[model samples]
Target: MAIPVTAIFDIGKTNKKFFLFDENLRELHHEYFKLTPTLDDDGFECDDIYVLCNWIQNTVRKITSSGEYQLKRLNFSTYGATLVHLDADGKPVTPLYNYLKPFPDDICDQFYKQYPQDEHNLHTASPALGMLNAGLQLYWLKYTKPQVFQRIRYTLHFPQYLSYLFTGQLVSEPTSIGCHTKLWDFSRNRYHDWVYTEKIDHLLPEIVPASKTFQTIIGGHAVKVGVGIHDSSSALAAYMMRTQEPFALISTGTWSITLNPYTKESLTRDELNRDCLNFLTIEGKPVKASRLFLGHELDHHLRILNDIFHKEARYYKQIKLQDSFLKKIHNHELTPSFYPATIANPLLSQDVFSSDNWKPNNFESYEEAYHHLIWGLTLLQVASARLALGNSDVKKIYIDGGFIDNDIFIKLLQYYLPNYTIEVSHMPLGSAHGAAMIMQGKQVELVV
Candidate 1:
């Protein structure tokens, strides 16, 4: 008998990736596609819904029809805080609004007044963020785009929307609902009263367990489909399944988010100002998380360095740094502080690094220059990671994603976080893989 295979659609803003995992949660084969943007009737840039639906349908068919593998199930893991509004016929009334589009300032102010910013933050377990908070998107549409909002029958988070395309079910997963949406009341474990107060309750789908299986017949194959999960929560699931002990995870990509699963503390005013957020696990428990645009900053500075030195930015392999250069950086006394004034664009600058001078002198090799640049980045990452740790006792720091591929970045992180054991994750397709694991109804060893 052939091993059972599960397919997953892992959707991101820039990339739509597909993965096939066998019964053991090993990746069998994977492919990725990019989404093209189309303007809606109102001339607002939006995701091409038809293209995505078609892609899902064709992909499912392709997987089932392939005689090489025994297809048994399917699931989805996607970026959070974006939703799709559907009509009575289950057709989208408008293009899927891009979350990157800014929410109106006045509307947010109105929400703050009614709920009180601090209380609302406490209730939702999510600090207020403009468009990133999915609930504000609904408010924006209801008040500003009244006509469009009225036509909506259901508002499904992006992940559930994809699952709905496959199973014809309208349900909410805990992870997606609890993410900075302002829709969920984490303390109460239900939708906030404001959902009905604003008459937007009908927009939300019925809540479903992330691990719930929705069975369907595709291409004459009986496949079990999952409700879908938030990308971050899914990533956490993958990590949790791998380890049985308490640990903190730093998932790096376009945005580097540090997540501490053990910390159940509420957000403070100061923490909120630093962009700290509380996310719900797939099981509906709060996971303390803070984000830094470390990847974005690294990319930006790399570009700046490349432009200035007229050389391509490459990885700095291990090489002996001159004692003099090391002494200069180490001996220079610098106080650790959050100097917001030095930040020209805090959102664009992922690394909290400030220096009077950063000119590169002629080094023996490119490795020396690379070390200097990465050392600066590592310092910022370490500080940001500490903020995420908060009052928790994290014994191990699990580093995952693209940062694991960078040797210098990992080494620097190891150097700074010497108190904790730094273990690099070996999981492939972490988010999608975790979603599949949830559907499989089993746990596997976490080999890092």
Candidate 2:
């Protein structure tokens, strides 16, 4: 008898990964592949959906025919803020538009002008993120590209679309819909009024729980396929399962998202302006989340510093957390000298951090300068994390992903959030693991 296994496709903006886990949920094999993106109709670079679809189908056939392990289940965890519009015949009507594609300013201004209430944002728990709001993408299509909009019969978030390819199920999950898509009304537990007013909700499929699964045939083998989940919410689900205490998670990557699922406070306008939003759990409960482009900023600054300091790439990885450096930063004896006034804003621009300002002669050593950068970022992180925490009594803070290896980032976070117990999570479970776990009827308990 072969070992029973589950396969998970963890798709990101850049890397696409496939993982197989045994009956006990231990990772057995993993493969990482990068897909080349193609330009959208607007010439903005976007995912080549045809390539992705073929890769997924080919991988499934290859796995099921191997006869090494019995493929029992399949699921997906992909980035949010992207949608796939389907024609009446269930074919893609438009390119998989990149979330980073700049939404037209005219369209954005027009939207707010028509719906001037700040309460609109609060109710949906979605800020003015332009193209990042999937619902706005539909709105953009309706007004700007009415021809394309007219041909659409259904709209599916990226993850569910991937699931649809195999299961033939057209459904939406809360985790994807609730990810600052400007579609879900978090307060009312339904589509926002604007969604109906615009008739964009008419294109969306029936809502389903993230864990909902359907039996399907693949390469002559029977498999259970999940409805799929948003990557960030999927990650939080992993931590939610291991601990029973009231805790907060800082999932660090290109974006450092601090999530507090326990906060009871209502979403506020001020929080929206400060880049705070809500992500939904698998069961459709809102999780307060605050985000920062921390990793992007950190890497951007590091590249400039590396050239100035004449150090090899990743030299900052060798630097340890120095108490003397940390103390001066904490005491304000040494300010975040390298940062400009625009540091107050979480959004980044080329002019905000000019490489000319980062002179090597200004610092005693690379370590000192690096520590200052981490200190500054940690301060911002503390502030962002606090927004997610709000009035919640969560005392435990778990740091996961890229920043886990950065000693300075971890220590500085600990210094700033002293009241909370901050620790690095070594758990192997990530978004992919969480998606697989969901298919097994597992629920993450948060009661302490």
Candidate 3:
């Protein structure tokens, strides 16, 4: 007799991981690896498609052939805002282009002008993210990389492409397509009309429920493979599956995303401008979401802190959150200008960063200055989280992801969201857990 376990591959821009989960969703074994990226045919940097595919096959083959455990199921959870173009031979015809690649301004301008942005963007519940919208990548390819576009017999989001590798089946899952991709018309509950107008919809494979799985033959054994899900939705799925009531999940990482499954109204123009959008649940339900570059900003701010204070990197680990500082934050007495105006990124405007009179020079110590910066950050976080809290019944806010371990951050969040129940969820591999959760059933059970 062999031990049975579910195998999951969680793919991200910087890390590729494989995990084995026992029957109760506990991690049995895991492995992490990094594959160096290479330039595409156009000489632009991108993930090497062949190398990634080869690694996936060889690793899974080795795992199953070892006889340590029986591979009961297979699933994938990957970052969004990426597409994989496959030719008629069911193989990649183009590089797995980076979402951050510079999209031509003219191409973006043309796309907005061709469609009524106020109506279309609001209806789609997506912001004007240019190529970051993913669907816009098709339009860019159509006009800029016509040869590559012509060779595409099918276009699959990154997660689906990974699933196709094992199941040899292509699918369009709502959780992946409904992310701020600008492809699905939330109001219409299908691909936007412009997709048909441009005939791009033809290349899309059939839309399948994110909860659906199919049989696949691998390593001379039958396997259950999921259709794939967007990483955000997959992470949300774990909470959604376990909880039986309305709640908001604030996932903090490079980007801090707040997802609310109970929002009642459609997104307005203001929400879109503020980076508020909709994410389809694993059950194909709309989840109001808002994003902020909280963690990234924290990193950049810390780097500057290290340089200014002449301290070692990651010195934050040594400093402890003080009760006095927490009280100052609670009373709104810790007003100070931090994050020099020169450090402004696209995520948050620095015009509102207040006066720079309280720079590091003003503080007696680096620890005090860093705490003040976080105090200001908490205020911004409350505002960002509120965007996703619109018209929802959620009273409990669950904080998870990279920053959950920060006692000061959690304390600040609790202070700000005093009206809501705040709790820190130590589980960080939410996306992987979610992929496994969706494996046992097709339609997710929603608590009324």
Candidate 4:
């Protein structure tokens, strides 16, 4: 007999993954692929929309028609800060623009002049992030590519666009709209005034509930298709489901994000200035969050360290928890020297790390030097996490994603945040599992 399964497409910046989960959500099978990006008309590299779209179609057809497993449902969780523009006839009008693609400085300056700094940004809970503010892409299009913009029928966030490929439905959900995109006004619970005032809202499709799903027949079987969700918000779903108490999730990958959903404070200018922003859950509530480029910075630091230490780059993995080093820190014997360079967060300056920037000359061995590196990195991590942790009584912190494997990093985190119970998350399939779970349950209410 064939097994009944649900498929989830979990797409992040570096990898695209497909996973099959059984009735109980145990992963039965999984595969990953990397799409070779193509250059857009403006010479900036972007996702090969046509190739990616074709890949999605071919993959789904193979799965549905295979008949080895009953395909009961499907959903997507994709990175935010991307858009797929479609024309009147429901075809892509331009390349899927890369979020990191530079917005012209002159144009960006003009945008701020119109919207202004605190006046417009504070209301949306969005920080000034150049092209990272996905909504600004609309203005970039209207002003620079009017001919291409004029033909647009609907502009879909990438996840919804992926869902549309299967069900032919256009949707806007809070998870994508609320992701520092400068599109949503959290207080009013809708598009920001600038979006409507500028008439950029016209290009947007009607928003569907994040929980909404469509039933469709495919390959002689009926399937439930979800409305799609942003990857970060979707990743938080599984944690939100299982944990009964208030907690913070430090989801680490290319970026290390500290998310606290229990906070009552509205984002202040000070918080926003430190790269602290808000993300909406699938249910449309704020997940007060902070960001650090610690993951990427670790890689960069390792490359430099390997060159200096004359060892294989992966040496850190061999070092277990440094009990002797911990004693030094605990006894105030290690006057830690800091390294100034860390990965840059767009919303904040590097000045926060400079005060303690000490040299690595004092270390006798690579292990000692590595400990120093982590100590400096932890300082930045703490600052980012504190943005969301302010005045909250969250007694537990759940560290998820890649950094959970780093004992040194986790131990430093525990030492720094001794007031909280720190534990590594057991679930690596957070985003995919979260996307699938939302299909069966009632909407989760945020903790007050």
Worst 10 residues of 2 by lDDT: 347-356
Cα lDDT tens digits, model 1, 1-448, are 5567988998866568899888888888899887789987657787788998899889888878877777888889988888888988998877777766767889989888888888888777776777789988888888888998889999899989888887899988788987788888877878888888999987787776787888888888888888888887888888887688898889876667788889857777667666677877777778888776666666665665566556756633334444554455567744222222222335323445454355544444455555666676677677677877987878898877767788768866886787999989877757887888888885332110
* Model 4, C-alpha of 233: deviation from truth (Å): 0.6
User: TM-score for every candidate vs. truth?
Assistant: 0.87, 0.92, 0.92, 0.92
For model 2, how does the per-residue alpha-carbon lDDT over 1-448 read when each residue is reduced to its tens digit?
7778999998877568899998788899999888988999999999999999899889988889888888999999998899999999999999999988999989988888888748778888978888888889998999999999999999999999999999999998888988889888887788888888888777888887776889999888899999889888988988787678999999887778899999999888888888899988877888999988788778878887788789999889989998887777667686344552323363422322334254545887778778777866776788789889999989998888778999888888887788999878775547887898887777433210
Which tens-of-lDDT digit does each residue in 311-420 have in candidate 3? 89878876768998877656868665664332233344343455656466567888887887776667667778988998678899988777877777788788778899
Whole-model lDDT, candidate 1?
0.76
Query: What C-alpha root-mean-square deviation, in Å, does candidate 1 show against the real structure?
Result: 4.5
TM-score of 3: 0.92
User: Candidate 1's error at 118, in angstroms?
Assistant: 2.1
Candidate 3: which pairs clash?
none
Steric clash pairs (candidate 4): 338-358
lDDT of each: 0.76, 0.84, 0.81, 0.81
C-alpha RMSD by candidate, in order: 4.5, 3.5, 2.8, 2.7
Model 2 misplacement above 4 A:
340-361, 443-448
- Please report how far candidate 1 places residue 215 from its true position, in Å: 0.7
